[model samples]
Target: MAMTNRDRGGKALELLREGLSPYVERELRRFLGPNVEAEAARLIGEDRYNAGKQLSDLDVAALLKVMWESWNDVFRKTLGFAERSLVSELREWRNQWAHRLRCGQNLSLSDSDPQGLLVKPEVARRQREEEQQTVPAPTGVTSSAATGVTSYAGGESSSPTPAGAPSTTAAPLKRFHGSVALSPLRLGAEAGRIAEEVLAHLSSLPGAQVSVTLEIHVAVPDGVPDQVVRVVMENCRTLKFAVHSFERD
Candidate 1:
C-alpha cells in the first residue's frame, strides 16, 4: 500500500467517522453538551474551524477517542480491531514486504557478476542428473492410493488357495510430502489460523473424495524469534508443520 502509519491512521479515522457519525448526531451530541459547536471545530482542526464546518477525516480518531473515554463499546471494539490487524493482516503488511524485497535485491549482486547472472537450465539439469546418480532416495517422497490399483507383491494367484491359507495384498497407504514457502508478509502471525480455516473448508467441499493431508514448511528468516515460530506451529499443529530457517542468499 506504500502507506505510512499516519496514512493508515487517517484511513482508520475515516472509517470510524462513517460508522460513528450518525450515532453521534442521534445520541452523542447530548453528552458533548452545550459546547457542541466549539467541539465541532475542535474535532476538525483550527484550520477548518469556521462556523457550520463539517467533520474532516482527521476528526474521526479524536471523536472516537472521546467516545471511547465515554465508555462506548462500539468505538472501543472498532479501534481495537484496527489496531490488532485482526480483520485482515494484509492491511499492515506493506512496509515489511518492501523492506524484505529491498534486502533481497541487495543480496543478489556480486563482484564478478554485478548483474547477478543465473545458471542455465541445461547446466541445472546436468547437475540434477549427477546428484541423482550419486544419491538414491532412502524413502519415496510420494505414495498413491487414489490413482493406483491394488496388487499382490509376490505373485498373482489364479488357482484356489489351500485351506487356512492367508490371502494378502501389499498396498501402501497414500501420502504426499512437500515443502511450502510461507510468505511472512501475507501469512504473518495469523498464519496458523488462516491455514486451519482454509484446509478445513477445502476438505469439506462436496467433491473432495478423501481428507487432505498437508505438511507445511515455513521459510523463516533468521531475525524471527523462536516464540513466533512456536506460536505458529502450535496453532497449526493439525497438519505436519515445521518452521525452517532459511538464509536470504
Candidate 2:
C-alpha cells in the first residue's frame, strides 16, 4: 500500500526531530548544565519526563521551542535569521498535520498547501478544452462592424479593435524565478498565508518551473561581532540553506 500524506508527514517530522536532537541536546546541556533533562521535562511536560521520556524522545515542537526560546544565549551564535524560516515552516507543518489527523481532513488552502493545487497535464488540457467551448453570446447584443466592438444588452462593451488587424498570440513563458525579502515570520496564520501566496502563484502557471527565494532580513544584536556573522552564514550553508547572505552595520 502507498504511504498517505499523513504517513509521509509523520515520517518527515520524525526525520526532523532526529536531525535536530544533537543540536538541541548540545545547546540545552550547555545552557542548563547538569539540569538539562530536568529542565526539558519542565519545559515540555513533567509527566513525560517522569514517565522516562528523554530529550531525544520529545516531539519536534518541543525541541524547536527550546532552540527558539534560548536563541539569544545559545542558538544565535551558530544559526542565522534565515534558519528561523526552517523552524517556522516545520513547526507549522507539524501543527497542521496534527490538526488534520484530529479533524480527519486536510487543512484548507488558507491554512496550508503542502501538496499544492496544480493538476496533471491531462487535467489541465481537459480544463482548457472545456473553457474554450464558447458560451452563446448574450442575447440582444449588438456588434459594430465599423469599430469591431460588441455591446451587450447589459450596456457592457468589449474593447474596440481595428478591423483586419493581425491576431497576435503571446509566446509561452519558458521559465520563472524571483525572490522577495520578508520580515521575521511567526508561526500559525501568518506563515500559512505566506505559504499560500507562494503556492498560489506556482499553481497559476501550469508546466512552468518556478523557484521562490525568500530573503529574511536579520536584525543583529548590538554587540554580535563579524566572526559570529561568518559562522552564522557558514552554518546556514552546512545545513543546506540554498541561498543566504549576511550584512553587518
Candidate 3:
C-alpha cells in the first residue's frame, strides 16, 4: 500500500530528528566546544549529568529551536549547501505542522530528491530579490537624526525605473525601528533570534507593505560579546534587513 502523507510526514520527522541530532552535536562541539554542552543544559536544564545525555532527551522541535537560537553562528558559517537546505525545510515542516507529531506534507515531494530533503534555497532567494528590485520607493525621505524615521513625502527622484519592466508603487518606506534587551546570562545569540522574530511579526501585520525595509536597532553596552554582535548582524542580513548596533554609556 502507498504511504499516506501523514505516514510520510512521520517518517520525515523521524529522519529529521535522526539526521539533525548528530549534526547539531558535532557542530556545537566544533564551534564552541564545551560551551555548547553548558548552553544546551541551560536551555532544557541539566537533569542529566552529561551534556550528550541531556541533548538526547530533547525532542526534535525543541532541539531545532534551541540550536537555531543558540547556534546561529554555526548555522551561518559551518553548515554546507545540502545541510543548509535540510535545516531550512525542517524549519518549514515544523511550522506548518506544529501540533501533530507529523506534518501532513510529504517530505519528499519530488522523485529525484534524496530522503525527502535537499530543497533549493536559490529559488526563494531569487524570487525575493526580484520583488525587492521592482518595489518603487517614494522620493525625498529624510531621516531626522533625532527620531530616526525616514520621511518620504518630499520631491520625487530625478531618475525613473528602467523602462520595459513592470512598475509597482507603495505609499512610502517607513523607517522601522525595533530593539530587544539582552540578558548577559543568556545566550547572546538570542538577540538575533529576537530580531528575526520581530521581523517575522512586522511582516505579518495587516496593512504592512509587501516589500519592506527594516532597520533593527540593537543597543550594546561596553565589552559586548562578539557572539551577540555576529549573530544579530548575520540574522538580519539573512532576512534582507539592516541592523544598527548603538553603543551607549
Query: Which model scores highest in lDDT?
Result: 2
The candidate with the higher TM-score, 1 or 2, is 2
Best by TM-score: 3
> Over the stretch 110-204, how does candidate 1's per-residue lDDT look in tens digits?
23421211222243345445765887332343224664432332343233345899976544434423345556564432344443334444455
lDDT (10s digit) by residue, model 2, range 102-201: 4555343222433421222343344445654865453456788888777755576766445898765433335444444443543323344455445544
Off by over 4 Å in 2: 45-52, 101-249
- What's the lDDT for candidate 1? 0.42
RMSD of each candidate relative to the true structure = 22.9, 15.3, 14.8
In order, the Cα lDDT scores of the candidates are: 0.42, 0.60, 0.56
Ranking by TM-score: 3, 2, 1
In model 1, which runs have C-alpha deviations exceeding 4 angstroms? 1-13, 42-52, 55-59, 68-249
Lowest lDDT 10-residue stretch of candidate 3:
112-121
Q: Name the runs in model 3 displaced over 4 angstroms.
A: 45-53, 80-89, 101-179, 182-188, 204-249
Backbone clash count, each prediction separately: 0, 0, 1
